[model samples]
Target: MPERKPPRAAPLVLDVNSGYDELNLGRLALISGQKTVPPGLRRWQKTILTPDGRPVVITCTVPDDQVVPHGLDNDFMVGLVNLCFEAGLPDGPFTVSAYGLLKASGFPDSAQYYRALEESIVRLNKANYTIDEGWFMHGPHSWTTQSFAQVNYLSYVRSRSGVRGTSVITVQLAPPIMESLRAGYIKPLDLNFYRSLSQPLVRAVYRQLDALHFDESTADGLVRELSAPLMAWGSRLGILSDRPDNVARTLKPAHDELRARGYVAEVELTGRGRDKLLRYVFGPPPVGEYPELALLLSARGVKSGVAVRLSTVFPERIEEAARRFDHYLKISSRPVANPGGLLVAMVQRPEDFAELPGYAAADARPGPPPAETPAKGTGKGRSARQRPAAQDELDALEAREEAKLAALQGQALVDWVLKQLTLLGTMKHFTLPERSQLAELVLHGQLDGRTVVREATRAIAGGAPAVLAVVEDVRRHLQVTHP
Candidate 1:
């Protein structure tokens, strides 16, 4: 028998999606270095400039019942997102045990830790944010305004023995972040390296630093050197003190830890007194965001841009496809004329390569094809008094959609939902939360996909507001019936 290589574990890195990373990078203070939040610090607002110096207002509110997320909440948030990727990035709700979350976050899975986890989750769930202008939409590659809770919803069900036994938790990630994640606006963070630091403050600082260093527009798509004024740095890291000396004192231990770990080559405080600026020269970045997959693709002569783009956009599928392609290349009866092109094709359409063992997971799971565009001038001359469609036409449309629903797999709900919105002429008017709610309904089987499309089509005559009303009614019905 030929010697075979052992299976490799997926990389232990958190793929921090864009806009959320900016929340911790100083636009909003989601993480705090303080062990306990000050009383009455429920709402805070700040105005910051975008990369192009456009002013944006960010407002963050913590519910009266729940405290602002602070301390170890950062670890929990990071761990939860990492778990999402590990589970293949399900687009809807998923269950994970509370103990599993604790372990993944580098905390001991004990009663106290479990309690801490529960409270942190609550805080995260109730935290509401409104970004008047700085939310980055990766699909459009533009900045826009947005409002959402940090988490959509969370349910905790404990076993009979409560803290002594396992407890399963269901979490729904917020919509805008999910959209950005799917759009591939992600940065890599070595979770193992993050958890290795001794101090919570150090870990928090390092998380922010890692995000700060990943600049997609830069030459290598990384900022090797970073500089910030002391006061602003404190705000970014959630350091409680505003005094220059106080901030410096609090940051010293974290700075020392980062330097000792060799992640930071040097940390310098330039200038004098309150005007002091802190600069960081970081050690080399990890190979590529998806190192193992990148290596396999590069070895097969794949171009760097193509490899990175595919890997970023399809992190879950690309790795599996690449591994299968590797095995196929080794066992094929004949040589591939263009190995790079072949691998690229496989990654893009894994279902076509299902005969390969590595692509088994992707079998029968083709992504939805792009929606067809209506020809120009087809609906261009319609007046405000015009009816969207005859009642009989809508009935036929509903019947056709109902027929399609029986064959629809859960993965296509988002696209199907978008199609309905597009038909109603309300796609641009719908908020992210509204779109997410409609998708979640179809995904969880709370509402039939056909009903969504039917209602949307029927509401078209009344314009976007009417379509919005139908969505709200569906959501309310689900809440009352299911909750």
Candidate 2:
């Protein structure tokens, strides 16, 4: 009789506290749709700083669904794994907590839990996913730290059948290891030294795959045959080793490992394996596929560009409509417009109010003030005595107006900040100079701060047309200072 497979392990609940609530769950919610988040997963309000020092919130949650046989089915599990890698967690040791009602739901083997966890880690790590922290537990006495630590640190996890499982695994994205892999793959290719060939290889492979005349019946044969030539192409590009034997040996282990993990099978590529290979051989999917913009627009109930365009046209005297539009573009996965061309056009013929909706013709005739009657017994001399007192009142009113103007300037600064947050949801990669300039633009009622303005100008111009909208906004705000 065939050996019976052990049952799956119960779902392990994970709670990540990255020091920011937005970074925690809001960011996740932005990336993964709210539907994927387990029902009853409470998002606690909190704040944490990104590597770049921008403040954000952490998303907190508790598992609500029954543990699935395969951990991959759990959205939270996958999200956390992706987050860890994206946050560069593997560079150093870090600690996170996992708590939930643990019961043997599927796998009877107590060791299955460890196996599943380890497999997840390894799969992520081998895919160049970054994680550096060791797994630890401070729970009941039934769970021993020493045993868990030992099992967790192992490079691979073994299932009950003694076959190494690929559910979880962890590996360091150290420079030397990456260099070795690149050298081994690229050395045979006679191309000049270049750091990355994975992308070119992937594009070539994709084109090759697309051109093949194989049906499902012959797809397997095509894949096998094509792998050799593709490998040769990679070798010629200096992405593979010059030594044919060394290249074969190096690639064999990866093929075998992927095969064992069910990422790749004997005859056809599994969906999961295909995705992994695409990322590994290419890179992360393009920004056009980023989920945050989709989520924001969906949640804010924006069905089309009408609302956005209206907001851009009329910012309600608070935020600059153009700037807000630019913010939307920056946070959006959409490509940005070219700055040089836009600037040239803007300088050549500035946009007129006639082009904008809701712009009415200015009235040419002035209206007279209402007529005032003199009080009884009032004369020129008496009016002169009253002149000083009247002047004092007028002076006081002028002072008050000045104060209000200053206050409005302060508020504009604050509004600018809020507008930025609305655009760029907390991500860790913005530069310090950029942040400082953003803050200044809010407070000073100006975007023409020489260095800062130049930076903002570059940012707005480098990408989509939406950025131009933002540049226009900044220009309008700066007008207040100039006029």
- Compared with the true structure, what per-residue lDDT tens digits does model 2 show for residues 124-171? 332211111211112242111111111122232233653221122222
Question: What TM-score would you give candidate 1 relative to the actual structure?
Answer: 0.59
Alpha-carbon deviation at 467 in model 1, angstroms: 33
lDDT of 1 at 353: 73
Tens digit per residue, CA lDDT, model 1, 1-483? 001112112222233332123233323445675566687778766565454457677777886876667788888877776665544445565444455567667787578888788888888898888888678774455887888876787866553545321344557778876665544455555666777789778888887777656654554445778887888778655666768999999899999989999989999998877899999999866454666676667677676545554564456676677777878887888989988879877775565676764434533554664444555668443432233465568889878766665565553443344444443444445344444445556666776766666777788788868888986777686567557
Using Cα atoms with residue i matched to residue i, what is each candidate's TM-score against the true structure?
A: 0.59, 0.19
List where candidate 1 sits over 4 angstroms from the true fold: 1-29, 47-56, 158-165, 288-483
Question: Each candidate: RMSD to true structure?
Answer: 16.7, 26.2
- The local distance difference test score of each candidate is 0.64, 0.29
